[model samples]
Target: MGRPVVHFEITGRDGQALRSFYTRLFDWQIDADNPMGYGMVAREGNTTEDGVGIGGGIAGMPEGEGGGYVTFYVSVPDVEATLTQVESLGGSRALGPEKISDDLVIGQFRDPEGNLIGVIQAMSQSA
Candidate 1:
């Protein structure tokens, strides 16, 4: 099967402000206890659902980074293998095969035209 765009992120200099704006604008549910300066956006009436309607986060930009950018993450079966494929296709690793949880690994890369893209590997239910 082909990879599917599974997630998205919006990074900015002010995470709280961004979170507030999005929450008000979309009526999303954003909690205040994001230790990483990241806010999870839960759509109304579907807060308990998993993988519904393009899940997203609002993140604070790292120090020295100029502005905000949006990134979309594609779901993959294997992050390391996808990184190799990205490199072979003239892309370059931009972030990591980093673990977000015991069941999720994520990575980012720059495409040939320098667009930042993300990939995620979600562990199987039987894993």
Candidate 2:
């Protein structure tokens, strides 16, 4: 089966301003209580009882990164292997199959046309 697009992120220069704009524009409720202050809008916050929409995060660019971009993450089985396949398919690694936590590994790559994309993998407990 093909991988599924799971999560998304919108990063900009001013996270609070972006969060305010989006919340006002869409009547969304964002929670930015995390250490990074990344505003996260849960899927249930936007989705219907039947589950219609994907969850996403809004945040500022890392310190000194002046610009921003929106990217969606595709769920994969093995992030490192997927990155290798991405390179083989003309896509170059942009970030990493880095472990964000014990359970989550994420990576980013630029497609042949230089469009950035993200991939995520759920680490197996047995690993």
Candidate 3:
């Protein structure tokens, strides 16, 4: 089977303004109360197997730091292996197979033409 694109992100230098804009523009329910101030768009009933769409986040970078970009994350079985394959295919590693938590690992790469992409490996509980 093919890998699934599970999440997306839209980030810029001003996260608060971005969040507010998206909220008014799309009527999206976003929660950004955490320490990272990453606005997680509410999935509603969309997180279940019967759900209709994917979830995503909106974040802001500190001044002169965050470059504005939009990217989606593909769910793979192994972050390291996928990134290796990506490199073999002429892409280059941009970030991790870095573990974000006990159950999540993520990475990024730039394609041959320099399009940034993200990959993620989510460990199942049974693992």
Candidate 4:
């Protein structure tokens, strides 16, 4: 199998407000923090009933302009191996193997087009 879009981040101007909107609108359970400006919410992309990846977005604030979302994540069976391939393929890594939950390891990277993407390996599959 090939590397798939596993995880993605939604960057916006008002992250907290967005989180609230999603939480109430989508019925998504959101765990939010003020200082961290991050939301732990279940995005439809990575999660399915059976088992899949998980991701959320960083809370953003309006910074002199309109708000928008940026950054996305990809799903990989193995983060280390995929990261190697990314480097070899001329992709740049922003962060990695950051443990988000018990079974989730996330790596942030940029593709050849300079588009940011995230790779997620759920613990259920990691084992």
lDDT of 1: 0.83
For all predicted structures, in order, the TM-scores are 0.84, 0.93, 0.88, 0.62
* Model 4, C-alpha of 105: deviation from truth (Å): 0.9
Worst 10 residues of 1 by lDDT: 42-51
Candidate 3 lDDT (Cα, whole model)? 0.88
Off by over 4 Å in 4: 20-37, 40-58, 61-69
Best by lDDT: 2
lDDT of 1 by residue, 3-114 (tens): 7887788988988899889888978777656567578765445344573576778888888996988999998888888899999999999888998889999999999999
- Estimate the Cα RMSD of every predicted model relative to the unseen true structure: 3.2, 1.6, 2.6, 5.0
Return the clash pairs for model 1, or none: none
Across residues 6-51, which tens digit of lDDT does each residue of candidate 4 receive?
Answer: 4456657777777778778866777675457577666554467877
Model 4 scores a TM of: 0.62
lDDT of 4 at 24: 80
Local accuracy by lDDT, each model: 0.83, 0.91, 0.88, 0.71
lDDT of 2 by residue, 1-127 (tens): 8888989999999999999999999988999999989999898869878888999899999889869999999998888888999999999999997998889999999999999899998887224
- Report clashes for each candidate as comma-separated counts: 0, 0, 0, 13
Q: Which candidate do you rate higher for lDDT, 2 or 4?
A: 2
Q: Tell me the spans in candidate 3 whose CA falls farther than 4 Å from its real position.
A: 45-50, 125-127
The lDDT of model 4 is: 0.71
